[model samples]
Target: MLRWVILAVVVVVLAAGSTLLMNLSTSPGTSWNLPVTPAKAGPMPKAVVEGELTHEFGEMGQQQTGKKSWKLTNEGDADLQIWKGTSTCMCTVAKLQKEGDKLTLKPGESTDIDIEWKTNFVTGDFHKGANIETNDPDHPTFPLFVHGKINPPVVVIPGDTIDLGAINSDEPKTVFVAVYSPDRPETKITEINTSKPDYFKTDVESMSASELESGGLKAGNKINLHVQPGFPLGTMREEIVIHTDHPLRPEIKLTVVGSVSGPISVVPDRLRMVTVKSKEGASGEVRLLVRGGKEAHFDVAQKPEKLEVSVEPIDPVGAKGRYLMKVSVPKGTAPGLIDGEILLKSDLPGVAELKVPVSFLVGAN
Candidate 1:
């Protein structure tokens, strides 16, 4: 009986060991061959703007104004919060329908965003955009495009203003501007007037077919302007007014900006004779320089039939273009203000004539 009981106990132990090995190899929690279950994903916020991406304004003028609107909706189950709306250009303005400090839209809600553009002080093809900032993860930033072509009544070739930056006074420069109507092909320029006619030489001519094509127009007139020398030394600004036959735009104004540098410059253009010398006539010397970077030859012409003047080369043997002028007043001249001028006439094209003033303050010696 004892042997049988011992044998049975060993059989039970062997069975228990087999069960432990099977549990470790084939259990779902510890088995390496089992598939992993993925975690659940939550819903996300989505921003939706329904409309045309680009708003085009065809043939707009400076006097024209219009607005464009877009529908903004939150299609997702989460909240859609708009941070701000920013305009890319000064001529464009963007805002929400109901403006406030902060803007928020609930799920399934909609709102309108209006973008207004003013066609003032602009021309040619223009493109601008308005940026929308939101809390949507998919679309953090949205761009609204605005593009158009602005056609003015009259298109000024090159530009409305003529800028002849720093130029030598001895070199006359010429520029041409064409004025034509794209809307009205038969538009004509009746008259062209310059505020300072003495400074500018104007000539009018019809634009050729090739010239009109180059300016991207069907018809136009070419205005030739020659900037003359002898403008008062310093900065100069002038206006050119054009009279056209167009009913809406009858008059157009253009500006000319430039600075003239004198080729033949006189160091003290004015001579002040203070008093007569004790022994001899009051003598003074004036210097002249040729700034044209070339050989200069001139003849001195003095005013007042009796004024005594002498011209001498600064460097008699050198290649520099410089000269000195000596003037003397008679000792017995009467006491008063005697005004005179010394004129230098040269062969240079731009600096052909130059004048220097001379005055005598005759006092008792």
Candidate 2:
């Protein structure tokens, strides 16, 4: 009986060991395979809310204010949550609609976001940016750009060039260029400058502060450019640069050309008088007499309390197109070259003025 009992105990022990081995090899929870290290996370797949977007619109006239639409879509596999969307200015606004929960995007599905910007305030080349945030782990945030251009309703009637008829150097004259725009309510003139400062001056008569505040100039609205001629004489060519809020016509160039009369040819075209003595005056003359163009005119105008200037003409009436001018500097002038302009008014419209530099030497005879 003792031997049988010992044998039975040994058998039970063997059975128990076998079952433990089987469980260790075949059980899902007991497998001896090494733990797998998780893969390195990749960059997010969020694309530009909209791919390569652009827009265009008509001028915002009083009656016909036009608008354009820009759309943004998500192309990623996961849901794209727009944390924020904003514009460069108050003229633009963006909106997104919700259909249901889950942020609603299946693989390859897309949603649209509408962007409406007021074209009334925007003219010329326009660039606006929007910021977007997403749930994409790799790229959580991105930028969306909407680019476009606008043309004002007004057309530059004289186009690029204007020729004002001639006049005497002693006389002052004004010329007008007409600007036509059908959409005048939304347009404004931003800036105006001249290429030749001494030869002419310009003013905008039609554009108002209220129009500028409202938007800018539009079509059918007329822009009157008043150009004033300066004194002295010879051939004159200059440019008027006008800047507006219009997107397509931001910068406009107007040309001014004419001729003046004088003798004493001076190379280098312009003069710079420097280092004049305090109690003495200096003189410089340029002889530019070319026949075939309009007759030349010459004059001298002085500025600052201490300086006096005179332009002495060699001929009273220039020989059709040729004449001479002598610049006279007087006593008690300041030490530096007295700076002023010799303006020559011409007989031609828009081309009526020519500017010459007048300089006086200081501390020199």
* lDDT of each candidate versus the true structure: 0.74, 0.54
Tens-digit lDDT string for candidate 1 (124-146)? 88787677788887898778777
Worst 10 residues of 1 by lDDT: 91-100
Q: Report the Cα lDDT for residue 122, model 2.
A: 51
TM-scores for all candidates? 0.45, 0.44
Question: Which runs in model 2 stand beyond 4 Å of their true positions?
Answer: 1-80, 85-112, 118-123, 138-143, 157-178, 182-255, 261-272, 275-280, 286-326, 335-337, 341-357, 361-365
- Candidate with best lDDT: 1
Using alpha carbons, what is the TM-score of model 1?
A: 0.45
Which segments of candidate 1 are over 4 A away from where they belong?
1-45, 50-66, 71-84, 89-112, 122-128, 133-135, 147-155, 158-175, 180-191, 195-206, 225-365
Question: Candidate 1: lDDT of 256?
Answer: 88
